[model samples]
Target: MNKNFTLFNVLPLVIGWIGIKYGINWLTIIATTVIVSRSIMSLILSAKLHSSLSHLSETVRSRYRAVLRNPQLTFSVAIINMISLALWGQEESLIILAIATGAYFSVRHQLLRKT
Candidate 1:
């Protein structure tokens, strides 16, 4: 229905896919569920935004593209996820919170700029 909703749906699916590749135990399952749910939401929420993929800086674009093209980013995100998960059981919560914060900032800066 909206871009943010779309992003919310897509972000988790992408994140979950990464988690599945690099995740361990129950986390992998959680990631898979998130992936499926996000994918559905993303598809339902499609809008008129540019390809999220097209906005990357040249260097980042190349690197991330390479990572996405391969399974490396999944491993990397997995590692980070593992570490975050290890951090006193607060990892997932914090990461989600951080993601939400980032999303808020992005929406403000890009879609809702104050002039």
Candidate 2:
């Protein structure tokens, strides 16, 4: 499979892990800097491409609404999160949750691709 990386994809994990190694303050500072940089780059690209900010925002808004509108998906995710939260103190629960969550996403992705 091909791995696609973007600012939103890779930066947070790398920076957050590094920050954890250093300190909470370092994490906040690095995360804020990265977010600000990404935002500025987005603005610059949008200006160069003559894309309307409202159009971009509308696309994101619609996607959020689409996800919220899917009752099955919304309830499934809520149940998953609730299970994880309920078993918050148990390592086994987390392991099981991760496996189940990963499988759910993988199956969904495959089904979507075929459709």
Candidate 3:
């Protein structure tokens, strides 16, 4: 994984961990709020993009389809990893969480840049 992406994924977790240690609910709440907001924004943007596809020329449509491929595939992996985290032991869950967060950041960053 790229260092910057990894850093982006890990930094929030680290802050949340500290909050947990200190019994600070606001930090955890803030993190959850950010994640939820980002997810909502992504959903809106994706819906708009898909709706606009019909308006593009055939060549552009083909190029866009090639570039976009299937974003749902990425979301599927993230969902599976999350489910695994719930089923895993503490150490294993942490690893799964890290991987999932990395994937989330990577996809979110890539899509943001494209838009």
- Against the true structure, whose TM-score is highest? 3
Q: All predictions: root-mean-square deviation over Cα? A: 14.2, 13.1, 9.0
Q: What lDDT would candidate 1 get against the real structure?
A: 0.44
| Candidate 3 lDDT for residue 107 | 45
List the candidate numbers ranked by TM-score, top first. 3, 2, 1
Candidate 3 displacement at residue 72 in angstroms: 9.9
Question: For residue 54, what is the lDDT in candidate 2?
Answer: 33
- Looking at model 3, the pairs that clash are none
Which parts of model 1 have CA positions greater than 4 angstroms off?
1-23, 47-115
Model 3: lowest-lDDT 10 consecutive positions: 84-93
Cα displacement (Å) at residue 67, model 2: 21
Full-model lDDT for every candidate: 0.44, 0.44, 0.50
How do all models score by TM-score? 0.24, 0.32, 0.45
lDDT (10s digit) by residue, model 2, range 1-115: 1243335435544564566566665664564455434435544543433333234455554553454343474235435443533433224334444444444444334333331
Q: Candidate 3 on 1-115: residue-level lDDT in tens?
A: 4674344334445555566678786775554444444445545655565556446676766565565565675455446434433432223344434544455455444444553
TM-score of 2: 0.32
Off by over 4 Å in 3: 1-10, 57-77, 80-115
